[model samples]
Each structure stands twice: as structure tokens, then as C-alpha cells.
Target: MEIPNRGKNIMKTLCLAIVLGGLALSSALQAQPSEDTVSVPVSARQLRIDLPDAYSKMWPEDYRDLVANYSLSNGQTLSIISRGTNMYALVDQGPPHKIVSTSRNNYVALDRQLKMEIVLGGDQGASGSVTMVVPSRSLSDGRFVPEQVVLLAFR
Candidate 1:
């Protein structure tokens, strides 16, 4: 029977630990974002948030069943469509705009309807109001769901 040497066993264990440590370090490094994108520091993990609101290659002609009970029409101007107290946003041809910011959850698209946690960096317009809006986000099922879109303007 070959007796195990305490010194040899200790060295072997240390060598194995060093190898595992190197592998773990390399894995962590690989998980980090590429050099190009900006990184947002979030607890538990890092994330990359890219802007330039995702384009809708195919905006369903009837993406949503316009409220039969309520319809916005009669050739109204964009101003008529968008005008809020806190955050003002409307669908436009150019890149979408936002008057609200995002938080851990619940993306508020309008600021005029409720108190905002963060203010916008740009001008809030002449209404003496603060605007903050986020681009519309859609789910895998192709349904539009903004972080927060207050449809009711005080009835």
C-alpha cells in the first residue's frame, strides 16, 4: 500500500485550485460586454442599453383595434394628438421622442399625468412643464406595451 504524502497532497490541491481560479477569471472576463457598447452598472450583472428606437419594419395596418367607442381623427394636427402637462409625446415620422424615463420597472411614457422620478435633459417646452418619454416597447407577441402610457387624461 502506498502511503500518501501530506506535503504532496497539499501541493496537488493548491495546483488544482489555481487552475480552477484561472478558469473562473477567464469566464468572468468573457461575460463582459464588447468594447463598443456603453455599459450600465446594474446590481448582480452588467447591461448594454442601445437607443435609436427600434424601427417597426412592419407596422400592422391594424396593429391595434382602435377604440370603437373612442377615435382620434377628423384630420387633427400633431399638436392635437400630443399635448401633456408633464410629458408630451406623439407618434411622428422621425425618431420617436420620450418625456419620461425608465426605472427598475413601469416605464412611464407621459410625465404630465403623474409625478416623475427623473426629469428630462432637454427642454420641456413652453408649458412650464417637465417632459420625459420612452420609446414604445413591444413584446415577442407583437403587442405594443409602453412602460407607462396614460390614455385617460382626467376623463
Candidate 2:
């Protein structure tokens, strides 16, 4: 049995259309922006604070005006206290750091001497976490090191 010429031509045309459709679909997909290439807007503000103590201070015996307290996963306690218009973070009875609010629930504390930044974010008066970006030291010369990010969860 031999296929008709007309039928062969129709089959060839269908195959070509399918091939072209596939190519078009592939090209359309390629033209789309990749999920990995995301651009986020960043805003930087310069803040100057004057305090009697360092950014972080030990848990004060007579501390007042408590705002929120969280317990970290590493058996550490983090307390946020308010004094006038500023907020302070006292971690595990350690030194308190003056954390400046960036947003409704986002706060950041910077140590210029150590070139370290600590970012705290999450629902205020609820669960939250702290992220510390600290500068790393080069093993060879103890200088020219990159920054290391450390995340600590709290509740």
C-alpha cells in the first residue's frame, strides 16, 4: 500500500508546524527573566548615637522600660529595652547594643570599631531572629578578610 502524496504533504506540514511551535515556546521561555537574577532596592542611612556605654552592655541590675524579650535557640536570652527614643539589645546578660530601628520591626546595630553589624527582624513582641554579619580575619596575615553572616533564631 502506498500513501497518497497529499497525505504525505499534510504530515510534513504538521511536523514543521509542531517544530516551529516548539522553537517559539523555547525562545519565549529564554526571553523571560531568570528567578536567580533578582534586584532588590537597598536604602542606607547614616546614624550618629551618643551613649555613656558601648553599643552593647552587660545586663543592668536596674534596667527599666522593657519592651520585648526573646529566648534564642542557643540557650541565650535577648532583651530589648526602650529609653526615650532609642532601643537597646541586651543579650544573655552580655553588653547591650544600641539598635536603631530601620522599619516597623527591623532593627540594626553597628560596631564601627569591629566593623560588625547585627540585624534583628521579625514581628515585634513576637518571634524574631538576629543576624550578625561579622568581619572575618585572614588566616595568613589576620587582615583583609571577608564578612561572615551568622543567623540566630529566637522566640
Candidate achieving the largest lDDT: 2
List the candidate 1 regions with Cα displacement exceeding 4 Å: 1-4, 34-155
Residue-wise C-alpha lDDT for candidate 2, range 1-155, written one tens digit per residue: 68766445433333443454466557556665785653322441222222223333323442333366776544455677766656677654546677654443455554421111333443444556665433344433444434434345664
TM-score of each: 0.20, 0.39
Error of 2 at 54 (Å): 22
Clash count for each candidate, listed in order shown: 12, 7
Please, what are the lDDT tens digits per residue for candidate 1 over residues 1-155? 55346334333333443454465557656766886644433553221222224322212231111111211121111221122333233322222233333432122333233222222223532111212222345544776544332211110
Location of the lowest summed lDDT over 10 successive residues in candidate 1: 67-76
Q: List residue ranges in candidate 2 displaced over 4 A.
A: 1-66, 112-125, 133-148
